[model samples]
Target: MSQNNAIYKGFKVSAKVRQAPDAFPGGDVVHPRFLATVTITQVSTGMGSQRLLPPEIQQFADAPHAAITLALTSAREAIDGMSTFVKAK
Candidate 1:
């Protein structure tokens, strides 16, 4: 992690979900995939922004909103745990 006067703008988390439309009589439901992304940027340039990605989750819930919430929660945890800094190159 590099503290290059980026001014710790903020962070964000997003998730994508999918549902199968076809089933033969009865089929095991496919779980949605939850992804969490944390972005840190500077207020000035917004360039060189860093993105923190958590391991792709198997599922958060049966719906998109729930999955998003869960992903965000995970992001929060990750953010809370961030404390490292990079030396100037």
Candidate 2:
């Protein structure tokens, strides 16, 4: 089966992207504009599924890979920041 998600820093990240609506009148929809979504959940949560950050939405006009990559980067940064907070206090 194909993998649509990745485990990173003990967090599960799944991505979904939608094609952009038709740019021209009655023209074919293009991927030049995509709505990207990334959901991050802890790998092991004592309490039911715990999400570090709420579902994030990103607008991209590039390839899905680029969008996913950006989403992952944002997730990692958020996770790292959260880790710092937890460790600081």
Candidate 3:
């Protein structure tokens, strides 16, 4: 697993890359797939954290860096208010 963090539009965007689970129940991962996750947190006081993307194995990238990039982009959209992610309680 790899993690990266950045501050964007007063929101803290944290992203991480994780390897997807094996396709078969007891088989090796023939082609490893990397999945990414993004968590967006409000930097201001009295704000809560929000998960921009779920860490599902169904969505993956060919490379770890690519996965991280994908996660960050999604977080950026949410932080920019372009996404429908819930802002506050």
Task: Name the best candidate (by lDDT).
Answer: 3
lDDT of 2 by residue, 1-89 (tens): 11258787677877777665546577756547655677777886644445456566454546666666776677677777664223222
Residue 20 in model 1: lDDT:
26
If scored against the real structure, what TM-score would every candidate get?
0.41, 0.62, 0.65
Error of 1 at 69 (Å): 0.5
Misplaced by over 4 Å in model 3 are 24-30, 45-59, 82-89
Candidate 2 segments exceeding 4 Å error: 1-3, 22-31, 46-52, 84-89
lDDT of 3 by residue, 34-83 (tens): 88878776674324544343332223688889988887887675556545
Instruction: After the best TM-score superposition of candidate 1, give how far the Cα of residue 24 lies from its true spot, in angstroms.
Output: 14
lDDT against true structure, model 3:
0.68
Error of 3 at 85 (Å): 15
The predicted structure with the larger lDDT, 2 or 3, is: 3
lDDT of each: 0.43, 0.63, 0.68
Worst 10 residues of 1 by lDDT: 1-10
- Candidate 1 structure, TM-score to reference: 0.41
